[model samples]
Target chain A: MPSQAFAPPAFADVLAAAARIAPHAHATPVLRMRSLDALAGCALHFKAEHLQRGGAFKFRGACNAVWSLDPEQAAPGVVTHSSGNHGAALALAAATRGIACHVVVPENAVAAKLAAITAYGATLHRCEANLAAREAACAAVGQRTGATLVHPYADARVIAGQGTAALELLNAGIGLDALVVPVGGGGLGAGTAIAIAGVSPSTRLFLAEPAGAADTAASLARGARVTDIVPETVCDGLRATLGAPNFDILRAAGAEAITVDDAGTLAAMRLLWQRGKQLVEPSSATALAAVLQQRERFAGLRVGIVISGGNVDPHALYEAGALHGARA
Target chain B: MPSQAFAPPAFADVLAAAARIAPHAHATPVLRMRSLDALAGCALHFKAEHLQRGGAFKFRGACNAVWSLDPEQAAPGVVTHSSGNHGAALALAAATRGIACHVVVPENAVAAKLAAITAYGATLHRCEANLAAREAACAAVGQRTGATLVHPYADARVIAGQGTAALELLNAGIGLDALVVPVGGGGLGAGTAIAIAGVSPSTRLFLAEPAGAADTAASLARGARVTDIVPETVCDGLRATLGAPNFDILRAAGAEAITVDDAGTLAAMRLLWQRGKQLVEPSSATALAAVLQQRERFAGLRVGIVISGGNVDPHALYEAGALHGARA
Candidate 1:
């Protein structure tokens, strides 16, 4: 891995990215449900990143990275390894700049996301299921296409770009007590922690991870890297092993970590679908599960949760929970 | 039916409501999209009412109506007939004031919506599936419980309240060339027309209806009321025959009505789910369907489409369109 330094991003970085992509990116809204807030025993504010361009917070970083590429490098274009949102985001960002994009997507990736990447004018290189295969395929594509690799979470610029969402939320001038985020590759969590630390120091930063893929929690506990664990979470986006640079930034953030079971995540997803009426991916639901499972801890606090994405196969929701009891 | 005289509301009513509800309601954001613009052949600016309280635009009117009631009347609480969003909205509004609320919901209402009404400390009185049964049940409930009736759309307070959304959107200063709203009971569309006419006269207003239930369309063409059309649309929220007062307001404001087929609605719903990554209800999708269908008329114009609600049943989405493809 060609790693960038793991220093936390500053408020200036986020403000600059927001300015750079002001015309391209959406300033997504924050949603609130007062009755649901009473149930959670907290004032719950949802930052609706699921409605952002390319359907996830990944677009902010993707746009910044693709737009920042040198003219000659832009000619050859950008490359990334992602099974879903990041691939589509980079494709859209590159397409906006009239540049080529190569994506290494797994063979078992959701078909809708693959179609989206293609629709955004990106060439896809399908790979096997394993991490080694994904890395190998990515290397081959980057070498053959002479495309600059935009590591989803490990790059400094990408992390800086990801902080822009938190900036926009804070800039909305709503005073929130806590900021909750899904722990995926750790870019979002680390960026959010850094962003809130600068703009709103009082807001506590918490990371929600699927219990099946609690790599970030384990890594934080071990005080060193632990990359041997295999993830089996339904939250596909959070399956990545914590990146080295992201781990370093997260540690500096003093971020709190919460683990939610797949069942809990599904319950949270159902709550949002039925009550909040937003179709969100399982990854986004993880953050909600954290607040729901530990309601006492969050009681009376004003909390903000990032609704990370909504790129699920609606068929999968039927398959997993079609006739599930509403109150369950 | 008891009806009020046709009269346009003052712009001051909108400004007053905005100030009155500022601390209570969300200053809902105005979201812009170039991709949707390209698809609709118009510069599309979506006012995201789907993120509002009760997951629909009905909350603005319901809140305003409930709050504006005489203190003694509000204490006895409010009653309404709705199988969907308006019921939930009134329940929430009444609960916030710690008042008694009675809602007459149809027998075939969404199971989740019934739960929402009860969750908000409101009493639900279920009636038969027909419209006559709903109104009769609502009247009986009001008489028996000694509650004030909060009519869904025809009430003057509700119309003035619904206009608050358009007022907020224009306050964001998007300067759209036209505004399109999904027409059901016509509170939102009619209110929007009056607000736009007074505050931004250059912006034209439109009501988009489902072709399967095009009462508003026929009524506008015939220059009178159209009643008893067989409503076969999947957009359950748009099933109501227009209230005489709503027709009077929209007709006086000169707002035209457009209708799109069920297939067109499904296509629009799919585009919102897949491309926009949103989970809006079929009622909200009608306006988007209308805009997507007529590219020539709105080409290159800044068009505002109100995403009315996000209360869809996940199963409904799968049933309406699992394998379906959206037509560009």
Candidate 2:
């Protein structure tokens, strides 16, 4: 793939992606928790992508990318470099189309996540736990298998596909005052920006970023992509550096960053599980944490928060006592 | 309340209850998990009552009872004796109607459950951890406050309310071959039996009971209600002895019992959280466990499993490492 081919997805592309992936991806519900509303001082409409296929919004993008390929292109199958949800999402999407899929996983990837990818019938290619090694491994597998590479966040089709979740939310007629999405590789955030821009122009876009992995915030502030941060956060899903195309789209959309510490994210995660009765991962909690932390900004407003994923390791959560406490 | 007044609810009452509680209760989604279906060798239609108001199917019954009261009857509010979901559900239901709610809780009740009852603005009265003590305490509260006693699973109105969940599931046009529900005091089980009988008479009713609290199974076997078991299980919600009306209704409906041990319930709970991405409690898992345990009976059938609740103590689940295992 050439750099020139990496143009940002337009709102029309998101519309097209929505149509393309409708047959595959789930239109997850928009849930309202009155208790959560009282705690946050806002009417929170949670777009439950955690309940989507593959248990994440990543499935939308992965499905779109796989289905968008020409018949000949798809015959050789699709490949991607992901240590998390995208790997499983791509595998599941490919399985639905009866196509082969390959995933280049880092050595340090979570075992449970890797198991999920394998369960979805994707061939795994192990690589060193770094960007270069992951990319090199993915490239080698793609070259050998004649598989099309689906960049998790940077690809235009993926961005458009990710926007479908927001498009569904916007179509729900909730009239959200603002939309908050957790920023990882920025696929969801950038795509949400495009959706809000097209469907609900007045609705503001807010990116929830972990303070430990605040590269997205830094990139937006500097008006350029930042790729130098060594991520350290409980939110495993939001550990990636923002992709260049994703950065450009988010910055262009004037999306604001709301950074939350690990403590806040964990607290919010507990609230979602305990009060909201939605066992979402820490990354999903960042969006709610941002709303709770900045009460003045969201108070009394109809705020839309995207629950990005629900792929936490149950054993790890139990062993670490991650949600343990009297308050929990 | 007189023992003579505890008439078994008919299909007509369930129909009335559905209309009465429609505004207050959630018509929870019927979720389908392909992986779970594959694992159980059956097509499973999961009635997600865990996503119901107050995070359990108890809300349907509680709300119906609260709203079924006339102005004169509702003047002093409502009271109940419960160690878990019923307490919180009644409290939440009373709150919706702007009425005072009182819960007589056993001393041995989970702290998290007590906290939830309190959070819903219900006054909690602690008593000895015995059925006699609980009944006495509840009676005292009702007398002192002039409140109507809303027996958790015995009252006709409550039973009718519980039937609404099964009604919704049956109305989903899935044509279930069998319907499974957890049987504690058997409010949900009896209600579901009524619903199945009314709408889908062809659908067999199966009660999923905890082996540690298998009073329902014993009662059905011996053709009489049993009340002499000291329950010991992680499923805190399924410890109550079966009510006479609940037993009679279930027996008349020809409902069968499927007993699952604590280990099987825990494993199923893990699967619901991991693969289904629904963080349900041990009690809810019993239904799925029963289906898995008796695969020969359910194989190639459309099985409907009601996920009873999602109000597990997050802290207890973490600190006890309840969901800990390599497979989790």
Find the candidate with the highest DockQ and give its number: 2
List candidate 2 segments past 4 Å from native.
A1-4, A326-328, B1-4, B326-328
How far is B224's C-alpha from truth in model 2 (Å)? 2.4
Pick by TM-score: which candidate is best? 2
Each model's chain A TM-score: 0.94, 0.97
List interface RMSDs for the candidates, in order: 4.7, 2.6
Candidate 1's clash total is 0
What tens digits encode model 1's per-residue C-alpha lDDT throughout A138-220?
88877787888888887766777888888888767789888899997888887787788779988888899999889899988
TM-score of chain B of 2: 0.97
Model 2 TM-score (2 dp): 0.95
Model 2, A262: alpha-carbon shift in Å?
1.2
Which pairs clash (backbone N, Cα, C closer than 3 Å) in model 1? Answer: none
**DockQ of all candidate complexes:** 0.36, 0.50
User: Candidate 2, A70: how far from true, in Å?
Assistant: 1.1
